[model samples]
Target: MTAPFDDLRDESQQLDSLVAALTPEQWAAPTPAPRWTVAHQIAHLAWTDRAALLAMGDPEAFAAEVAKALAAPESFVDDGADEGAAQEPAALLARWRDGREELQEALRAAAASKAKFPWYGPPMSAASMATGRLMETWAHGEDVAEALGVERPPTGRLRHVARIGVRARDFAFAAHGLPAPDAEFRVELVGPGGELWAYGSEGAGQRVTGPALDFCLLVTQRAHRDDLAVRADGPDADRWLDIAQAFAGPPGRGRPPKGPRPGPAA
Candidate 1:
């Protein structure tokens, strides 16, 4: 299996390619994410990359950063993006690039360690952190691509995102202040390569089934569940689709259905 660190590097580079050639005006163009422009998307990713670095390399500093976030849960993320977005486009891009590289190295160096690191939620290993980073890059890159009126075809890396989404069923419920269903829910996703990726037991009573891309999009909150092909067989399963979120943090204010508008190109 390819390392999650490698997958993260590939995903980050893909997002970087989309922005590397963008003009300053293009960088300032608004994305599908409300009040956040293309620059803001990239800046947010860059800021997060830096945070991940701190979490892995300097636990004390990361805890201080966490305190800041707790003090301003609603605005802290926006504040980071806004601060980074204030920089010149070139400089912001450089910071993102450098930050991701540093994070990549941190993950790589700790790949053999079983130690868990602090995070907004529970602690995670190096590989889990890398997977989370990949998911974030892909989700934010979706925003940047839509802003540029371009499409990024789903890649095999989406498997990583799908896996996280499937595993986050409980987190989804908890994020909404609801308890998770006691019974496991079966998830069967059709990957970009047309292979089946299954989670939970085959005999599970509740189930979610769909194209992997749509599932990832729905889980990431990049697309509304109503707009996706995902299906749920039970009441709890149906609710999971509504509340699914792959990334950690507070419950997201998910995107509404695009209502008659064409989505990103194929």
Candidate 2:
């Protein structure tokens, strides 16, 4: 079994590499996400990583705390108080880097001591937390890559993304106010490191297959599945292609340009 620390370390290194090469002007460039500058995207990431660190430190207690925090108005000034309010993007970036380091430390410490972490909903093992971070960083990294007009570098971290894609099916069903699909589907990906990331049978149908990174990008709505080389077989699989939500919170309507979805695979 691969260690959680390895995943977390790789993600941090990837993030650092990206940040290091960015010009100050590039940092301020507008991304595909409407009205969100690259700076804004990173700020959101920094905030999220910090939040994850806090939650990991106190999983059980933080579960209730997260509920209350979510209830409160989301404002740096209000939620983080004066010190956080004063920090600008550069400061936020510095703090974000720090948070990454802190999370690595937390993961290492947790592994040695057997610490548990709180997640958005369910309890997360320290290993899961690392995967969750890997998933988030890579997805968000796509946005950054888009802003810079660069193709994303491939990585083995995609396994985490595949898992998130499967989980998003639940979000998709819930968003449309429909009961969960009656069948499960297997998901396979063809990428730098092709693998059977996930397989479902019976309940939600069977078999979802394609490029690993493409599958992840498409499901997260970062890229259209049609735009990528991903292919999904089975009934529910086609339906899943219509909508997939990975992140938590309320469902996003996603991009405009409504048009006919491609017909089912032959």
Candidate 3:
């Protein structure tokens, strides 16, 4: 398997390729994310990569930025995206490409040193950071793809996203002001190649089962849980499906179901 940093680079490159040929008009096209354009999506990625770089290379500066974010928690992310989106498309694209490349190099070095960096939550080693970056890249790329009317086939990299989602089970509950469940829940997902990726003990009574794509989309808040094929076995597991989120923040206003709820897999 490729290193996590390599995987992150590949994910960023994939997103870069998607936008490399887009016209300025296409860059301006609005996405499913309320009021955000395709350019805003890429800009957000660039801003985050730079923020990660700051956290790694200069903690003091990163701390100051964190304070700013905390001061305006609701608008910080959008404010950063808006600032970058105001740039010309070509300039914004160049900025994103350069920033991601720099961050990828930093990640490789940190991985070798076994260094940990600050995050919104706990500190993260390079591998964990890379996995997180990969998740956000794929999630935001989905918005850009939707805006452009493009289809992105699932890849093995989604396993990283899935693992994060599965691991974040407790965090998801906490984010929604619910107590974390005590019993371990088994999660089994069908990967893109039809392989079963299972987590937790098979003996566990509570379980979540479905296509990996749906699970990943659910955890990322890119798709509503009701619209997905993912299902939960026990009441706790079912409640979990209602508010799973891979990313950190106050609960998001998630996208509505695609149509009438297909309901969970049974």
Candidate 4:
């Protein structure tokens, strides 16, 4: 069986390859993320990758860093991105590549351990940590791809992202200080290869069904629920779509419906 880290590595390599060919002007292009350029997206990834490495190598040091971040949760992420964005494009790319390699090595080395790594939210096992990394990589990569006017091909790998989105339904509500729904919702996504990936009970009253790519975009806040092909069958599921955040953080104000989605590349 392939470990989540294997998928993480593949996602990282795909994003790296995509960015490596970008021109300097393209790197500076504004992404879908408000106030964040392509550089900021990559820089943020690099910063988190370094933090993940620290968490793996030295828990005490990582805890200290986490404490500092907790002191200013709102600004910590942006501040780190600003620092990373100051680097020249080459330097930034190198830093991200090195950090990613280090993180992968650490995860592999710790595969046998049952230790939980502390994060902004709950601590995570190595497998969950890797899945989170994969989700982040794909989410941010969408921003960069959009800035370049490149259409990212949807893949079966999006199963990881959809799973996270389903799992985060309650987290999304809780992050906004709202009470979580009492019942779980079934999530059914059609993979790029036409496979059905279903989660939760088939008979659940609340359910979300959609194309995998649209679900991913919605969960990542790259596209508004209104713009996606997804459908929520119940009130709770509908509310979840209004604020479905896969990444750990405050509740995100999802993208507003900005005209119809563009057609696929001819």
lDDT (Cα, tens digit) per residue for candidate 3, span 24-46: 99999999899899999999999
lDDT of 2 at 134: 79
Alpha carbon deviation, residue 227, candidate 1 (Å): 0.8
Better of 1 and 3 by TM-score: 1
Evaluate candidate 3 by giving its C-alpha RMSD to the native, one decimal.
3.3
Encode model 2's per-residue lDDT on 53-131: one tens digit a residue.
7787665666665777567624431344234424565776787788888877877677655556666655677777777
Residue 176 displacement (Å), model 2 = 3.7
Every candidate's CA RMSD? 2.6, 5.2, 3.3, 2.5
lDDT of 4 at 50: 86
lDDT (Cα, tens digit) per residue for candidate 4, span 172-208: 9999899999998888999999989999998899989
- Provide the overall lDDT of each model, using Cα atoms, as 2-decimal numbers: 0.92, 0.69, 0.91, 0.87
Error of 4 at 94 (Å): 0.7
Better of 1 and 4 by lDDT: 1
**Residue ranges of candidate 2 with Cα displaced over 4 Å:** 59-65, 68-89, 112-116, 194-198, 201-205, 256-266
**Winner on lDDT (2 vs 3):** 3
- On lDDT, the leading prediction is 1
Candidate order by decreasing TM-score: 1, 3, 4, 2
Q: Model 3 segments beyond 4 Å from truth?
A: 261-266
Please give the lDDT score at residue 264 for candidate 1: 100
Error of 3 at 42 (Å): 0.1
